[model samples]
Target chain A: MTDSWLTSLITATPQEGFELAITLSRRGVKYTQPDPEVLHRLRPDYANSADSLTAASHVIAVNFQTVAAANNYWRT
Target chain B: MTDSWLTSLITATPQEGFELAITLSRRGVKYTQPDPEVLHRLRPDYANSADSLTAASHVIAVNFQTVAAANNYWRT
Candidate 1:
């Protein structure tokens, strides 16, 4: 995504990103994509699992959308 | 998925499936989950790339959701 494209989301708690999403939300106004290794481990336990995290919905959406894009790229 | 778990989708024309999806949509009423090889190739070209197909929204959704699930499982 472009730089300004990500400025749109409002996380319930900025900290929920790292706490619930395993993301580095506390660092800056800009979000670099999370490390691939971290992303690998932070996946939802099941479909819609991230729906329950109150403060990290944006992170959850980011996570799901990234994977969905990758999936769109390589179906397998 | 269970036997009944797959009875949910309605692919239009049914024949457009194999054409647009690169899938074997004609054989049965139940969806067996496309082959891993075929799945790998039929993925949308971009985020929501499959949105253009007129007869296969179901296939696109299935493809997107499958990759999303796989992404949720592996994260990386």
Candidate 2:
């Protein structure tokens, strides 16, 4: 948590930026939880549930919108 | 995949913006890998790897940088 991990988000392409977005989302969960045991234990509750998956998607869309805005919607 | 889930990234606060960033990351995964079974099957491989988890953080940092820049580093 103390280590410096980020370098830049000015990706060469939208595809890379999109992949980075996924990583950001997963990392966010890790940072918020920080405990693997708890995360694993709770996996079952959401892994098999469609609702949970959809909710996860919703969260991603929100973040994507933010990223899109940052990159000016990847205007070229 | 075509539900049009995003509304806006102009969050009321940075905390909300950060949360949105996480959501965007997760959603990106879903979009990239629509098959839940595949995602579930591959989960165990990285779930326990510290390197994978750290990498996730790096990704988050990258996306976060994008978000930070978008928000002007959340400057007042």
Candidate 3:
């Protein structure tokens, strides 16, 4: 039911995580945090610290048109 | 210098790729094709078929706030 074509799962400190979200929001890109249970099921390796999800690095999702463009924005 | 915090490298057929791009564009998201040389250097495993890059599923990077969000959009 979603219109998003691609998603990016980024892991970063809480500060960086929110910063990226803000940046995307400013550009009018939609993004959100993955559900903890779902994330744990999908990527167990990175989901070791569920409690630390909000304090440590977190994942972010957004829609994009091309790989190159996504990369540029992700790095930001 | 980019605002993106994470990147997703999606692999789908050409039709699917363009379709996703269109979907994102309609949503006002920005995306582009990764530089062939840069993509090869960054991900040698997925760069085996440079010639087929356009024909095969391509990578699409984007910024996100959480892993869950990225996963949802990616599946779309």
Model with the higher DockQ, candidate 2 or 3: 2
- A7-42 in candidate 1: lDDT tens per residue? 422343222221222232322222454466655465
Docking class of 1: incorrect
Clashing pairs in 1: A76-B40
- Model 2 residue runs over 4 Å out of place are B1-76
Candidate scoring better on TM-score of 1 and 3: 3
Cα lDDT, all candidates: 0.31, 0.60, 0.32
lDDT of 2 at B29: 52
- Cα deviation of A46 in candidate 3 (Å)? 37
Compared with the true structure, what per-residue lDDT tens digits does model 1 show for residues B1-76? Answer: 2222222112344443224223212111112122455334333422244432333434344443433343343333
DockQ of 1: 0.03
Interface DockQ of each model: 0.03, 0.08, 0.05
lDDT of 3: 0.32
Q: List the lowest-lDDT window of 10 residues for candidate 3 chain A.
A: A25-34
Which candidate has the highest lDDT of all?
2
Q: How far off is residue B16 in model 3, in Å?
A: 12
Q: Write down the TM-score of every candidate.
A: 0.19, 0.49, 0.21
DockQ of candidate model 3:
0.05
Clashes of each: 1, 3, 20
lDDT of 3 by residue, B2-67 (tens): 665325525343223334443443233233544556544644332232222211211122322122
